[model samples]
Target: MLSVDNLVASYNAGPVLQGVSLSVQAGEVVALLGRNGVGKSTLLRTLVGLVPSWNGSIRIDGTPLAPIATHDIARMGMALVPQGRGIIGKLSVADNLRAAMRAAGSRPALSIDQAIAPFPALREKLPAMAGTLSGGQQQQLAIARAMVGRPKVLLLDEPSEGVQPNIVQQIGQLVRKLADESGLAILIVEQNLELALATANRCIVMAKGRIVHSGPPDEFRNEAVLRRHLAL
Candidate 1:
């Protein structure tokens, strides 16, 4: 479980996250959606310690995580699949998975083969350069790599950014499956309405660095709701 309370963070003293508070319980996938410049990404970055929070607390399973070290956060069972997927493009697919496990500095929760089990495409591309894979494949590698650590809380910035529609569908299914089967606590900031609606158990809308709306994914299906909160 991940809990953030009154989290306020800034870059160079200009506040971005203003008292943002939210929590993700085990087996829950909470989708964060809003227009750009609303601080969705900043919230995720602050959670992982990439951005410093001037106030509030972040706790994992009731354990406080100071906004100081990213590595320490990861080691404490929090993994991030950032906006760009952040894979080592030059490395082979298998090597990418190995690198993540190595970075953890201990035995990973899942072996390389177990990590790649969900992605059949990735299994066949083990020997190929990671850079050569499509954006969708690279996203898969990114998720698989993060899973090698068996994080209790997973933060995904945007998993369907450059992928095709069908692949996006697959990813949505996989994300939901992971939560259902492994009880992973997930926080995903997704602009793709379909993916968010299909994958998340609930949706929250962010505005000017704070949560303004919270509801089941179906509420977002109303066009008026989308236009009112998301400006779509």
Candidate 2:
């Protein structure tokens, strides 16, 4: 359960998220869809404390989160898989996962095997250098590392970036399955329409840093409706 009310944030002189409000219920996956620079990524960054919130509130299971450090937010049951998979090139995939558990700091967490279970391909690649892996593999590693912390809410920003279509489809299926089985609330900012509509239980559309429409995936599938927002 994650809640954000009247959330506002800025970058230097210009405002990005203008009084945004949204919520993602447990066991649900909500896809954030919008064109480039509509503040979809900014909202995710702000929720995780990477970007300072100029106003409003963010709560995890009713616990207020703001004026909090990024690492502290991760410890408080929130994990972020950023736009670009931020894996250390020199570190092995196993070490990357271990680092996440360490940050969890004695919190009930998932073992390396359990974390990599969703990604069977990753099981064998654990000993491989993260930098040498393919783009899709790197994305899987990023998400698996985040899951090692057993977060209550997962903020995934553009998981499909640089990944192949088939792999993107696989990830969408995995995300849907992960939400149902683990009851982890997920808010994903995705540019890929097919993946978002396929995986998400609900879809929220953004424009000019504000949420303009919220509906079921079918609503967003309409060509006319999609054109109004995305023009694809």
CA lDDT, every model vs. true structure: 0.91, 0.91
Give the top-scoring candidate (TM-score): 2
lDDT of 2 by residue, 1-232 (tens): 9999999998777889998999999999999999998999899999988889999999999999988888888899899999998887799999999888955755877899999988999998989989999999999999999899989999999999999999999999999998999999999999888899999999998889899899999998789999997877
lDDT string, candidate 1, 90-177, tens digits: 9999999988774454645678889999998988899999999999999999999999988889999999999899999999999999
What value of lDDT does candidate 2 attain over all alpha carbons? 0.91
Runs with alpha carbons beyond 4 Å of true place in candidate 1: 102-107
Instruction: Judge candidate 1 at residue 32 and give its lDDT.
Output: 98
Angstrom error of the Cα, residue 179, model 2: value is 0.4
Question: Which parts of model 2 are misplaced by more than 4 Å?
Answer: none
**Poorest lDDT segment (10 consecutive residues) of candidate 1:** 100-109
Each candidate structure's count of clashing pairs: 0, 0
